[model samples]
Target: MGPWQLSVSALAQPDKISHLPLRWIRGSRAVMAFTVSVFLSSILSVITAANPPYPPSTVIRKIVWAPVDTITRKAAGSDNLPVTWADDEAIYTTWGDGWGFEPRVPNKLSMGFARIVGAPGNFTGTNIRSPAEQLGGGRSGRKGWGIISVDGVLYLLMGHADRQGGQAQLAWSHDHARTWTFANWKFLQFGLMGFVNYGKDYKGARDNYIYSYSHDGPLADTPADRFILMRVPKNRITERGSWEFFERIDETGHAVWTSDSKRRGAVFYHTDGCLRSAMTYNAPLHRYLWWQQIPVPKGSADRGDTRFEGGFAVYDAPEPWGPWSTAFYTERWDVGPGEHGDFPAKWMSEDGREIYLVFSGNDSFSVRKATLVLAQKY
Candidate 1:
């Protein structure tokens, strides 16, 4: 089917009430209104109960302008980087073709590095790798790109291309950055080049669940394709993993997944190309979904361009898969000097409290921390 064909007719319509009587409708209308209101309220309550929003217990902390030790000062290089804080330390990955400012540099390689910081209060950085060491000799070994942390473990997702083929791989670090377990790195199926992005919701004090997104098939150029959501079981690692596939979009799209901390835990993915995102909570609204097409702000540089950097959406659901409410959609802030290209985003902390947005353009990259504070309603 086409991209916009997600079965959206299931959502209830209140406009149907207009067909009722006009004059005699006062008393009858009051009773009917109460009935409809009660029915709709019941449905909303069920949805909220199934996919509640994140609790206040999940505190959000912001870390900005975190210092970076120059791994390589190439006049022709761009610093399009991605960063994540795990185990009380911050990890960064840089990617780009050696160009403008940093050109003639010999070891023209993209790289990934880790730094162990004491805390947000203690922001001193330590260099984890050097340019000569990161370059190596591969043509497509540009650099590591995607970074995320789950259950105290660090994961890096990146791609490399050679005469053989190009594929994305996953690497894990157990003891922070001191060591890494890069064994059977799961490569993306041939022709697919992207990394898995993740999200989580906390239950009680120490329990929670994580979800990751990845896909297989028609490659980059194809328009009609579906992305798969793999719900990573708590503390388990293996390909015998359980995953579900959402219907394919007729074109490329971007999504942000968040978990609702209720029963079965709901997951909501906001897909861009289709101008809508779908939510998979329980069995009833299981098929029930909600979405809103946020237009690019007028007169902004992103007016006609859907690919503008830094555009992101975070949803609040009373339960997991949701009838979620849009918190806010903001224009891309130039984290980099000029244009910071957008990359996949991840929740820095649980409960949609804080979002870590990563963007890269040309040679420069940056990560911004956004908190979902109560937006002042006019």
Candidate 2:
């Protein structure tokens, strides 16, 4: 038998060792002690493997929020803000379940597009009354959770088209947010999807493929066990067959992809599960930033009123499929960061240190400035 097995077997039969030579007995005791140490270490190794520490992010050290100048210009109950920088040096976004912008729309809409022009500190939003926009209320009303601009074409990833949040489809607009054409095919598997945005018209993209992330669930409001990633050629976003899912991270730390959606693997995990998120590429820093809602406590009264008071978390990574590190986290905040949050690429400073976060805080369109604290390099 192997030494470890022999030592274990010897310990189980104490009577057999009682008659051994004095010197030999002493030697056996030494071996037994060594064996026990090894045994305990093996068990501890397994335990540590199952529960690893939070991975340290090599890029961002932390994020500092500037609350003094934070801006929240309410548009009378508007929410669900998903924005993308366009080639025309403006941000086109969509709002849900309210009158949009100033001089409010003639009617409340479940989904309406608006164009935001000017700097983050001073900007004006004008509502677009497109014939394609949906008007109504409640969960049955369609809304957009993600939007991106590629090559001057605005693509919006919308959910609840089939009278439920589980069904999602894509719609494209050539004239900014004025009009749109919805794709016939729908995605019933992933409802909450967010595109990895870059500079205006996707100018700072790392590759030709466009990447997107979603909770591994069918419902938009519900959290999933983990996050799933998908990608398609930048030119072929409308082609269902051209899309690929992240299957696994290879040994070299690079992501492996598969055409079969069923074989997809998780790219990241969170204690509270994955929910609606906003991801953007920090061009100057060469990192990807992901912002997610920190869900309200399950049994708390605030759970029902997260619009005014809630929490959020921000993570940064070298790539989209990340070894993510926390840039900021809060279990709860006085003024909730809102259910939907995004950092538009246009407002980022040249060094990528100063930026603005746009969210639906206080149940309206909100903007807050934040400075990135980069990790010091020796």
Candidate 3:
């Protein structure tokens, strides 16, 4: 087996010691104990060498949320909001299946781009109609899943070019999302990709790489068994060949990346499953926050109306490819957490305790205030 490969049974079957010749050691319990210890240690080394100690416990005890804030003019009648803070001191975001912001569009747009100005509570959005904007939803047009700004240019991750579960492409705007140039390449295998936000113009990023994540399946609405991660040098995001997929972790707990997509491994696993996520780095707390949507089960009443009501989960980690810990989770949130959500870095408090959550509830853009109760220091 390769160095990165591990047999599940090797760690699972710890009691299978029949292969050891106990007769040689005979009544010497000390020798027997040392022999077994060595055997177990070898197995543990192999396992740790192949994978990180995942699902690490969190420093956040829990998240306490206030009621969803009432919708203001700009946020109403839109959903699928993927946002990024630009260097120009404004938040740029995308909206789907609605006329965006005030003075609304001439007709409903499948996807539209807008720039938000002012603070979170008092901000206003102005639609920036672009020739690149898609006109319809679902099969007819594309869904905007992720957006990021680096060095004054804005990049958008477009999913569902053919279908929601089909393909994703990168489009960028040099003029603050006013005009875009689409990349010719398509992410053929990874259908839905969400960018990891690192504050204004990628300022607080841990490294030079821009990270992204996707669930196991192609469909964005459907739950997947695991989440996959990928990263590209911040300067080469549009170059298809520069992207690398996460494969595994070495014995040092450092991430191993590969250019080969097929060799990529899972970064996160959820028994209850997860969908597209909103991720941001909290510089004050030095943790990555992942706001993931939990899909309702098939054949259930909630499944048909998840847009209005369903489940949502929040997790935090020390890195983008996480040994994640749950910060908040609920099967039945008071209001539907929508299909998409984001915790814009600009809205976070200096101490990283108070924050605002932007999501689509009742099929409209919504905002809610939340407080983080951190684990007490020893």
Which candidate's lDDT is highest? Answer: 2
What tens digits encode model 3's per-residue C-alpha lDDT throughout 1-378?
332233577554433332232222344442343334334434543454222112223478778888555443355678888888899989899998888888788888888999988776688889998988888666467879999988999999988766644678899999987789999988876666889998888898998999989886665556665788999998899899999999975545567899999999877776435567889998899989998887777666333235688777788877787656557767678877787888999889999998888887777667778889987860
lDDT, candidate 2, 65-122, per-residue tens: 8874467565658988899999999898999988889889888899999999988878
Candidate that beats the other on lDDT, 1 or 3, i.e. the better one: 3
What are the TM-scores, per candidate, against the unseen true structure? 0.46, 0.83, 0.83
lDDT of each: 0.34, 0.76, 0.75
Give the root-mean-square deviation of each candidate in angstroms.
12.9, 11.6, 9.0
Write one digit per residue (lDDT tens) for candidate 1, span 1-378. 221222323213222221221212253343343333324434433444322121111111121323333211222344434445454435434443442122233445455453523322223334343322245333334445445566677665454533122455555666554455553645445222222333221112112444443323222222112233444454564342332333221122222332321112213322221121222121211111111222244455332123233343333333332223444333443322212222222223434334333433224433444444543320
Model 1 TM-score? 0.46
Give lDDT: candidate 2, residue 276. Answer: 77
**Superposition error at 107 for model 2 (Å):** 1.3
Worst 10 residues of 3 by lDDT: 49-58
